[model samples]
Target: MTNLYRSRAMQDAEMSNSSFLPSLPSELLFHILSYLDIPDLLSISRTMHYLRTISLDPLLHTYRLQRASVILSRAIPSRPPLTELMARRVYITRTTLTALNLGRSLTMIRLKRQLERRPTVERLIELGVLPPECYLNQSNGISTTLGLYRRRKVVQKEKVRNFLAEWIGELSKRITRRMIDSSRSTRDASSL
Candidate 1:
């Protein structure tokens, strides 16, 4: 009942708590873990001794290492498209990523899961890596093409504002719910 004894008892309780893993085979467990997202897997690994002990499988680890090498090589801007294409996969080159990052409105659309389904012929166009002709309106001749850009400049400004408003408005509800739940949890913990 002394403070030192209570602390020692709590330590022992925590140690014993880690020893009672369910009787799943390690391979099966690893398979299940592989299906989990990084967040969920990391959370489980933190609390479960069995999961923490699981090593990355050799084949999976090697595959990731190889893929990473190609990803890095292809991602280098100086590498030619043909040279990078010869590699396993042509990742978004660092130059393209940098261009996209510099364009805030493009990044916003990308993060909103809208880029993949964009009406543009290619998502790569938004990266600003494409030729100017790709963005040109084919129906319009040269003079009207210049006018098109001016008109689109106005339209894009409005679109960016609307997208920003939509983003903030969507997150506002999620933020309110989280704040309500957070305050409720704090109140319950204090009562305890």
Candidate 2:
């Protein structure tokens, strides 16, 4: 707010602190502040005594009460404690939403299905869910070769990708089968 209609005390407070909220019109200040929670209003009070005085003014609250009386019948509680529901209800800003976006990828879906259950390394290798070189000798809990780097040479990136796609596809099918079986049981129970 500008210094045009500011009182002597407000002008002095403004001069003392460089914490001015720029561009907010003085006329709208009270209206905006009224909507804010008690903690926020208290914080604002620390910035300027003028705001504190205005926030504490019984006249303002009385006016709010009178206005609210016409709209709301029940005394609703303030914000509830943070919970899963609260976290899920949060509105994501466009930038954050865009940054988080990873378009639906069939390869990832297929890979997730293929790797749904932690199968034996041998089984994984057999199903092409894991590259052949990634399979360790189960008896010793170590790779067949002493050279770990050499194993990487044998297991190319394309093989790994293919393995993942195969894994996810298998996992997806397993999940779908379980869902179908579950639905069939429910249907049978209802028929009985």
Candidate 3:
């Protein structure tokens, strides 16, 4: 008798906790599901057998694809023409692309040569062109130049530190002033 009573109570609890979506008409549920993306539909399919069947319906996917095609067709006319794109160099023929690539490679080679001939960091430091802070020592006792990125990061950190210090000083002054004013008011009230 106890087992039967417990089973009935569990069934009632489950019935109360069941989702209202399942109780909705199939046509309405499918209409709602049609607005959901593929990922949402897939997630819904994993929740229940009925939803899995509905979400995986080929007709829904075909409809979505057809709608997407229609939207893309409508948007296509708003894009720039091929001639304009070609004139802007956003679109190029294969031969032109090849020529551009060759020019880029030659420029890179020339830049590499110039970089190889550039003065060392130590020489620059000695010449007063670079600051002493640009020198960095590794754990292996080898010294290296601090690249532009590291220098920028160090400068940024200093700026943040200074800003925080100034902000904290102002905040402390404001709090001290508030405390003094409150104390003076309390004293004046007591005197009255």
Candidate number of the best TM-score: 3
Worst 10-residue lDDT window, candidate 2 = 73-82
Q: What lDDT score goes with residue 21 in model 1? A: 51
lDDT for model 2, on a 0 to 1 scale?
A: 0.71
Clashing pairs in 1: none
Best candidate (score: lDDT) = 3
Reference-based TM-score, model 2: 0.29
Q: Write the per-residue lDDT of candidate 1 for residues 7-112, one digit (tens) a residue.
A: 9998889767856455667767766655555577568768766676663355434544666788788888776776567364466667766776789777786778
Clash count for candidate 3 is 0
Is 1 or 3 the stronger prediction by TM-score?
Answer: 3
* Poorly placed runs, candidate 3 (over 4 Å): 1-24, 32-53, 69-81, 88-100, 132-192
RMSD of each: 23.9, 24.5, 9.6
Order of the predicted models by lDDT, top scorer first: 3, 2, 1
Give a tens-digit lDDT track for model 2, residues 74-131: 5434434446444675756666566556434656787788988668877877998766
Tell me the deviation in Å of residue 171 in model 2: 44
lDDT of 3 by residue, 124-158 (tens): 98999877767665555765456874778889999
User: How do the predictions measure up, each by TM-score?
Assistant: 0.26, 0.29, 0.46
Checking candidate 3 for backbone clashes, the offending pairs are none
